[model samples]
Target: MIKIEGFQTILYSLVDVIDSGIHIIDTKGRTIVYNKKMAEIEGMESDEVLGKKIHEIFKFKEETESTLIRALHSGKKTENSKQTYFNNLGQEITTINNTFPIMDQNQRIIGAIEVAKDITNLERLIKDNILNKGDTKYTFDSIIGTSENFLEVIEKSKRSTRTTSSILIVGETGTGKELFAQSIHNGSSRSTHPFISQNCAALPDSLIEGILFGTKKGAFTGSIERPGLFEQAQGGTILLDEINSLNPNLQAKLLRALQERTIRRVGDTKDKKIDVRVIATINEDPIDAIANDHLRKDLYYRLSVVSLFIPPLRERKEDIPLLAQSFIEKFNALFELNIEGISEDVYALFYDYDWPGNVRELEHIIEGAMNLLEPGDTKISPNHLPALFKKKAHLEEAPASKDEDHNKRETQESTLSLDDYIANTEKQYLEKVLKEHGMNISQAAKTLNISRQSLQYRLKKYQVK
Candidate 1:
């Protein structure tokens, strides 16, 4: 008995040196030994806890009892169990505890030793890991492009994410402005927070105001006192899409919100503090919008704290194959098809045609092609592409009516300058895609694989609207 007690004393002495708290309780819940760390954790001296009953030494709520004492009393062992307890000072601390029966030579339970490791830091780290998952899963990997221009825009956006300044994404429709916005949000420290988007053009003036500045219940018909995007996105980001579409009055209100870092509900008297990062997207030139009285110049200057221009798909043709492959893979999963790759001829056609609709268009085309593919087919041929793709005729039919027709064509084309000819060709292509997509700018932009803002800009530039 002397030797056994001595061994336990030495064992507890060693356990006291380690940071983890250790306690040994007999079958009746009487404390046999308590390490120095355990004494410190319970706000008692080692001598005070040496032989006290665990229930008496550590106070616990009656409803939620301690597991270690219960395990000792029940002769059951518990492993790697986590619990949060408040110390005498009411400071909450998290612990990972393991309690097991200490058996004698007869293999019968004698007492139980409880080992508890403070895991407050570990829990914090786990929370951080969960929050960071959003950042890693939706960053540049989601952007998907290999073109130099596209890569440069991504690089700049990545850099911009490190700062808290406002970012204005400028591009024609279907240029993936929101994707870039999301990438930036994911890359930033604010990744854990919400990323809210509001389309400025989609809502009417009254609704847009209520949507952005939320009204109190009974302030207006159907008002339920809901939080606005800014309020909902507190400590996160708010993406104002087609910011140029906001009327001058709303533009002023937005500027005030940006400047004050607070917003009052439409009918409320109190201004709520906000910590939202603003990222605005515009399809039109801000200078032109201001000149044409579409956007307020003051608001433009405030929103354009940091500006990034995404090149149109036509400008970055090198990325077409990469974007096409990404879209093909996405559609394959969505449609449950085995479409493996685009044919060499289809790629050649993709490169030759001016992608007036941009990246969005390419995605739709791939989805359409995937939908058209037969079961077990792994390749998408040019014939699988839409008829509009083949209408250009350079890849199919030879020039009809030989020399005389060629001469007449040359004479008609020569009437316009080289710049004008290119512009006309781009305009004609955009018109065709718009017509093909039933004048739905969003759908047309996606079918063209460009941003809606970029498509809208092209429509204006080509007078297609």
Candidate 2:
């Protein structure tokens, strides 16, 4: 049996390792448990906060402003509440907190625990960078595709530049939806004005509300009179990437803003008129998103004044060689190498592979292969490919069987469709990497070269435990 002291030490260690800030206070509001993450978030030592009262360490203008205090008094949970206050160092800190009352069997509150996700840096970035002047890096010429379908899409987009109607660009991940949005922005009369781009998946609904719409001072603790992305992009363009990630309430607000051509800042009653062109992008089909309850039907009608669909890489295999050479030349110039181009065998393997990640995956593979070559290397051979592609190449290059009956038998036994095979392989690879990292989403995502939200989506789709 473990001693009480040893068990307490173990519990403290476990709490310290948690990703969010944890703070537990006694009934009288004396801090009893303050974890390592909390210390980092609040910029104070645990020693300083361990026995101190909440009011002594942090300043709240009113008792109601503190979520932990509210939970303690009301004996109810306060979830996903945003709090902005000054820390011990007098620096403003912002967090989304979930606070709960710890009650005994008798239904009497003993203490309160609060879990906080620090977003001070995110708030600062939104205020400083996102609200600043916006410029684009890619124009129409930067897009590299010559397929007839793609050219038609480009021509339509060019025509779209003549008007100020909102546009919706739909495509799979890495299919350059943003590239098209930027090209449209640069081609339009708004080209000389600011062009701001924001991903809807980047922040929680509560924080994102104040970010999209302007905020008024005295609205909440530490909130300043600041203009949001909409106001910042006035007279220019604003690209809301992955618009379906936004909740219904925000979507309604966005739709209203679009219809009225006016915005009311949070905590302010006056409606301000603005002239801003809205551009929204969805990774999947808008119809699918709408059917799945991810997007609002009304907002869809308002945002899709003009819709552009970008075809994925697999559908346009004719452009594979063109994109491959473009990336090869790009890397050659960037890396200062004299590699001529991809070998015929590599091209054959590329043609056989289903590019699930589309153009971005191709560029990443080419970049990886270029990193392996030296200045004297003549061309990118199959041997220079990444391990994943090398495996696929091996499977594609399986020697033709001389015995017809044996080949027919083998084919009959292995009859899984290409889609099924790729799906199974991807699921297995995701599971392997997740297990290696002990299911830490951020670490697993970093190792997979994808975003955390993307990893989470794959996990949910595959039902990976």
Clashes of each: 25, 0
What would the TM-score be for candidate 2 when compared with the true structure? 0.72
Tens-place lDDT digits, model 2, residues 55-132: 898987554467888899999897767788887788888888889999999999999999999999887886578546
Candidate 2 differs from the real structure by a C-alpha RMSD in angstroms, to one decimal, of 12.0
Off by over 4 Å in 1: 1-137, 392-397, 400-465
Per-model C-alpha RMSD: 21.6, 12.0
Write down the worst ten-residue block by lDDT for model 1: 127-136
Task: Tell me model 2's lDDT, rounded to 2 decimals.
Answer: 0.86
Q: What is candidate 1's lDDT per residue for 52-169, written digit by digit as tens?
A: 7766656666665676676766778777666666655556666667878888999777788888866555446434543121232467778877877678888899899888899899
Off by over 4 Å in 2: 1-20, 24-31, 36-115, 127-132, 392-397, 400-465
Give lDDT: candidate 1, residue 232.
Answer: 76
- Against the hidden true structure, what lDDT does model 1 obtain? 0.78
TM-score of each: 0.58, 0.72
Record all residue pairs in model 2 with backbone atoms less than 3 Å apart, i.e. clashing: none
